[model samples]
Target: MALATVRFDAGQPVDLEDSLLGGQAHRWKRASHPELVEGEWYSGVLRGVLVLIRQHGQAIEFLSSSSDPQAMIPRIRDHLRLDDDLKAIQAEIAGDPNVAAQVERYPGLRVLRQDPWECLIAYICSANSNIETIHRNMERLSDEFGEPLTLPNPQGEGTGTITRNAFPKPVDLAEAGEAELRRLKLGFRAPYVHQAAIAVAERRLDLAHLVAAPYQEAKAELMALKGIGDKIADCIALMSLEKMEAFPIDVWVRRALADWYFPGQKTPTNRILLEWAQRYFGRYAGYANQYLFHGRRLRDRKPAQPESG
Candidate 1:
């Protein structure tokens, strides 16, 4: 297998851990923990390529299973959104007091530019689900239908080969009936997944055209899909289609807004919250959403301090 690698100085726009696990994408897995670096091995497949990445002090490194290793750099850069000026975006998002606190709390968090087709399906699984459920369902989809790929182990852990399934193409997934998908525990979303896969496989859902379209237009196109709603559309818009202004609101974001921004007012409608986010966070709302989301996850994971005695 062909092998390639890339590295970047630490504190760059990309934080592999935060960028992957920060609620934007759930398909990535923590492959191992090694002593050489102050980081862990992460493995993921995107657009038929398997990427194994890990970060150490002042440097992030990657190994890819693509034929042309260097060709993967552009994709990786785009995936991590390294081209964006994150420092500036952070300042812009910090306009909100709550998100400002998040900015100070989580410095390396970033929004990733994910593969659009996979991103859409992943978010479909996100509805009414926690991150753990999203991860399990997406993994099941890949394991059952997506192509299998093996990556070279730079760290030389187990057998020197790490295997994973690349996310299936629309055409492949289209062949899966909703009933079969339901068996994979997609539940009520089975039909929606089936329909979406069929639409893309049949060329009815043109993600390329949608990506080139205005943000709202692209959003409308995604919302036209079976299971996609305002939140899912914005998720795809921001992460996959390169619409930086898109802000997806989940219960966590809603709670944050209620507690921090709109105290005393009734819980705002989804439309109102979205409109308010657009106005408040402006063009980099996606980045702001990520920082806030990651911060919320961190807060939730924190162990409670002992009660004062």
Candidate 2:
């Protein structure tokens, strides 16, 4: 099990810590140096893959247990969105002065392209919650239903004692009873997760195909599932399917738009804000959304309810 090291020189725009912890994903947990067998790092299940990630100055590394670890590089790249040029994307979304200022402040914030199935359940669980609770719920879901894997510590010296389960696959959760799912403290979201898993497992929803379909079509299809709405659909489209034009409007985003962009004015409707973003930012509206999201997150320095979008 070799480690795949992807590096960016000092002063490069990508910041792994910001990208992982910036409210976009709730599953990544802070790991200690001894636990990781390296310096302090993070651990999480990316799709079905268990990865140990660390950042050393300009270098970002992915350690996976796949026999061909190099293959995981592209998968990680797509998941982490390392291929997209940050400067170019920022330039595209910086048309709005408020967003431009955010880009400058939050330098390497990028919308991660996560696994569609995992991304779906995650956002579904995100409604009216905080990141801490979201992480707890996700971990419980995985422990109850996901498959297990064994991976070495960073030094290949020994097996680490951190979590070994991956995020549950659709089939894994397809037959999960709502009562059992609710044991994970999913609240009212348990039935929604079961129904969504059934949809995917039964082939009623072909999530993989949607990745290449038109953005609107994909979003419409996602919204058709139980518990999915306009904001949730857009979140899945932008964060999971690489649809850069997808703009998800949630509470933080709404507040950001109201205070930063239109201070002392009437807060526009979600539809109007989204439409304005689509036309103003064009293909990179999602990245713009990240900056505003992260900037506001940092500025407020308080944990807000994680809207399901």
Candidate 3:
């Protein structure tokens, strides 16, 4: 096994637990029970663990423990589009004095660069569900369907251990019946997951096009999938497809804007909110919105319900 360490500068705000990927780990936890080996980093929440993460070509052993993640991984290497993405977002948000103020509050809120396939299914599972539930479902799905990896336990003799290899691919999930998934406690989302997996597996939905397609065109295409609606589509775009301009508007964002920006009024309709985000926040609309989401959620410290797109 290979190991490495990195540290964050003093006063540099970074969350290793939530840093490398999106801070939300329900999907990651669902995907694998990666061993958590803890050590001090910036604010002291770094872990050394083994997980199957793709690196350019094949799934390789990753010793994912962070110190100062901001200074460790070249930001550009962490995100394939770091330059254009940061530039676009910074410029777009600069137009809005209020949004700019919010961005200034959290210098670390960057849109995550995740594998496209993982992003798609994760967000699909996200529809009308809370993060905790999402995490459980992801874990259960992997335990049931994903490939598994086993390694020797450091403190034991021949008493080895096992963890799922990775998130199950669309084909893996598609092969499952609703009854089987229901047993895992997916509830009403079972069929949706089953069918979505089949669609992607069958090449009915060509997700590869998302890599270079215009954001709107890509979003419209994602929306064509049954379980994927506007919000989920945008999530796939922003988090998965690398569309920095994609803004996923959910109830929290709507309420946040209404409470902070609009005040005492009904949250703007989805269409109106979308327009406002694009017009006001511009190219980095997705990045700005993520900061707003993260900051607002942390401040309120309440779980917001997911709404239909």
Candidate 4:
């Protein structure tokens, strides 16, 4: 079967590299196929559909598995948050000089609206783990339990097919149990993922309801689950629950707050910093957090210049 293509006009600048692979979502891979060059095309599974997308100037081009590619546009839009006014959001969080620099440095980075259950489990695996580890764990979980899918290679005739796995559902994970999850190298998070999956699968936790709940309420609900702390809860709220005011304070973000906002002062607690961030950035604190966190990490990775002779 041939894949359907659609060009979506986002009406704003979008950097697919920074937005999709910049740490918000872990499933996307830079396409290695000859027809889809690295950094030009990305392949990922979204809500069970295998999607290959590329940024075409201001518009986005997509090749998806859906029979009705037109109907999937709405979902694609929501996933990428194309309707968000990037300029307005940047202006809102640009009050701080450091944050302003990040906005200027990395344009078109938007928080993805992800599936609640998937986001929850992903973050649970994120505790004390780096991005690479998280990606490995999620991939392992999906490969083991997720539904298998095959798509005609983008090259078409005689090029064979590509295979991908949909992210596993809560019922799938719950049935696998913690023992099976441990084999995936989830480590300490194995039980937590298992328990959270069981809760969602059993309907003991209503992730869908939290999407409409207030930020605090949503954070509280997520924190009540095993292995979810303030930071992870805030991540779920900001990325999935539509809580832009939720500021997650990871080590990088905490360093940003200390080095930029609270310079020369005693470092405050995560709770205190979160309060100040929400008050300072108001409804767009989460956006500010992402920019600062990503910007700081990138800055630190750069090699220092030699001292003047």
lDDT of each: 0.79, 0.78, 0.60, 0.84
Per-residue lDDT of 212 in model 4: 91
Give lDDT tens digits, candidate 3, residues 1-309.
323333222222333333343333344432232343232211111112233232222111132322333333444234333334454555567566656666676554455566677667767777778776676677778778876544333234444443334577788888887788889988777887787788789988777877789998999888877778888888889877768788888766766677777787777788788888777777678877776776666566455555322
In model 2, the Cα lDDT at residue 179 comes to 83
User: How does model 2 fare in lDDT?
Assistant: 0.78
**Superposed model 2: Cα runs more than 4 Å off:** 1-12, 33-36, 155-161, 304-309
> Cα lDDT for residue 98, model 3?
58
Predicted structure with the largest lDDT when compared to the true one: 4
> Between prediction 2 and prediction 4, which has the larger lDDT?
4
In order of appearance, the predictions have TM-scores of 0.90, 0.91, 0.75, 0.94
Clashing residue pairs for model 2: none
Instruction: Write the residue-wise lDDT of candidate 1 on 208-285 in tens digits.
Output: 898889999999989998888998899889989989889888876776778777899898987899999888889888
Better of 1 and 2 by lDDT: 1
- Quote the positional error of residue 300 for candidate 4 in Å: 1.2
